[model samples]
Target chain A: MDRLRQHIEQITPLTNEEFEYVKTFFSLKKVRKNQYLVHEGDEVKYEYLVLSGIYKVFYVDEQGKESIVQFAQENWWMSDYYAFFKQKNAGMFIECMEAGEVLCSTLEAREKLSADLHKMEHFFRVKLTNGYVALQQRVKLLLSSTPQQRYEAFSHLYPDLIQRIPKKFIAEYLGVSRETLSRLYSASK
Target chain B: MDRLRQHIEQITPLTNEEFEYVKTFFSLKKVRKNQYLVHEGDEVKYEYLVLSGIYKVFYVDEQGKESIVQFAQENWWMSDYYAFFKQKNAGMFIECMEAGEVLCSTLEAREKLSADLHKMEHFFRVKLTNGYVALQQRVKLLLSSTPQQRYEAFSHLYPDLIQRIPKKFIAEYLGVSRETLSRLYSASK
Candidate 1:
């Protein structure tokens, strides 16, 4: 909860009393490695705020090919937001990559917090703004970057993620062949 | 400014007085066809709300290949957001595809509105949420979808855009070759 307060305070400061109230909306849960948090077709009830370890938000096609939507770690939020906000069944899957703890909160709770506190609304808005920028960068990289440029950008942006995640998923995320990933990796060495 | 009020009110209703105050922060401009709202290396000072226009926000690579980030029409917000929000030089370009009008507002005005009014904050947050979901869908499509699937999804999502944008730009936006795009178009027929 202290970490959660720290995360929120990074954008907007909350009074101690206010944070106590905000923390109540979030319930903590342990995530085991390989555990499925949100499964396709399941109701997406809550968005997770990662406290530690890594998680992959992804989609599996009819032919069973996987596309990684994002890799989230500490202080990051993860959910099938298309489902979470609309109260629909999940169209994607979220899987725990390493054991960690996450604080879960419902969309209703998110809205309530915003309505109840202007600071909370500002906090959420700021977070969304950063997320929007990151997604824009992702689209640009995916569309125009060569494998080497992509690898370098990824390495620069998420050096920790590069060290932590498997090369297979990294290859998929970069939209490069596994062989190409190997060439980039060995060349970077 | 009625358009601005209506667009914001789609997510969070605003009083006439409040909207009047909000309108002061925006300046309306008539855009000519092929006009660039933003260009690479220029300072991105404002985000635009398309009052009446078809616009493409895109990036051109070193080899002069263009990739469309988004095709925004009436009621859509467009900008080099990475630069706009951060007060940095633009990394992309936004060009008008059809002559129309846009309301431009700076980051300061945006922050001022969000800070001054909770309803305005909610409005911006909701808009960002929708944009985030759309980007996520795009990332998924780009990562694995076939040309036919991409074309069909684009057609379904933006039938209006399909009718307005050229097939060449459409092919580039979908990350498909002109030949493949032609095949998809004829096959659909």
Candidate 2:
């Protein structure tokens, strides 16, 4: 797909022939709102690259408490990465929040692409580098930031996400109560 | 340097010549306990591969609260990675907890190595993959795990670290009060 080309090319350029070869590894799937792409206990066979709409990757704990690991939007990647990498059954679920399409690729295909193309390897490395940095920032925020600080940082980083995602999920992501989030929302307004 | 070669070879095999070429990009540094490898507001120039001893990567907040981001032991890499990749001033500090040796390599050297050798690129990518997975797991724990769950997870994952790191620092890292961590410690025993 053109979007996939654009996404990969954002890191490294690919010739038409190379692009064609790379595209063969991915298959497109259309998803509907409230549909599940991945479910806990199922095998996580593919990681999705968002072509449109939004999705949440999360897990429910033993106490039946839900915690969102991340959200994926257009041009983003999503999977239960730990299970995906280990070839284990999923420990998380990816649920569609809006109707969308995604390009799915297997870990085998990803490894083959990287092995077969130096440019693809470079592209994946750079993307992973960026992802690693972002997760590090998130870890720090979760560790030390207060509710107010977390709300401010989230809004500053993802103004669009704030407008798009429900307030309750936003509150959960910030580790803040709904009342606290409501107060912060009112103050920011 | 042999350690460096061995570390890389754990992921991808390299010819002696390739290993020699790769080692040249790194310089060895001996660190003393309490020495800071990076300080907030300083330009973060290198990411260090730990050879021996322990180090803490952390940041101080406005109210002078210290938060431990990660602990590095032998064969681990430590850096203000966001700053290192972005070529910006460090927003965190890496302090040596025990006298040790580290192999320091600059961002330019890393890029050059990755560009020059496909094996090196694969090596870096694999390391980043592992690190990314570990951080994601940490984020999940921080988001939902109780202090007891956190302690059990930590001890299960890094029993050696439990013995090596100070109990106070471990409490901070787990985002638990000292008394709570102490109770967990006693209960575990």
Which candidate's lDDT is highest? Answer: 2
The top-ranked prediction according to DockQ is 2
What candidate 1 gets wrong by more than 4 Å, as runs, is none
lDDT by residue (B1-189, candidate 2, tens digit) is 899988998899999889888999999999999999999999999999999999999999999999999999999999999999999999999999989999999999989999999988999999999999999899999998999999999999999999999999998888888999999999988
lDDT of 1 at B170: 95
Which portions of model 2 miss their true places by more than 4 Å? none
- Per-residue CA lDDT of candidate 1, range A1-189, in tens? 999999999998889999999999999999999999999999999999999989999998878888888999999999998899779999999999999999999999999999999999999899899999999899988887899998999999999999999999998788888999999999999
> Model 2 — TM-score against the truth?
0.99
Q: For candidate 2, write residues A1-189 as lDDT tens digits.
A: 999999999889999999999999999999999999999999999999999988998888899988888988999999999999989999999999989999999999989999999999999899899999999999999999999999999999999899999998888787778899999999998
Q: List the global CA lDDT of all models.
A: 0.92, 0.94
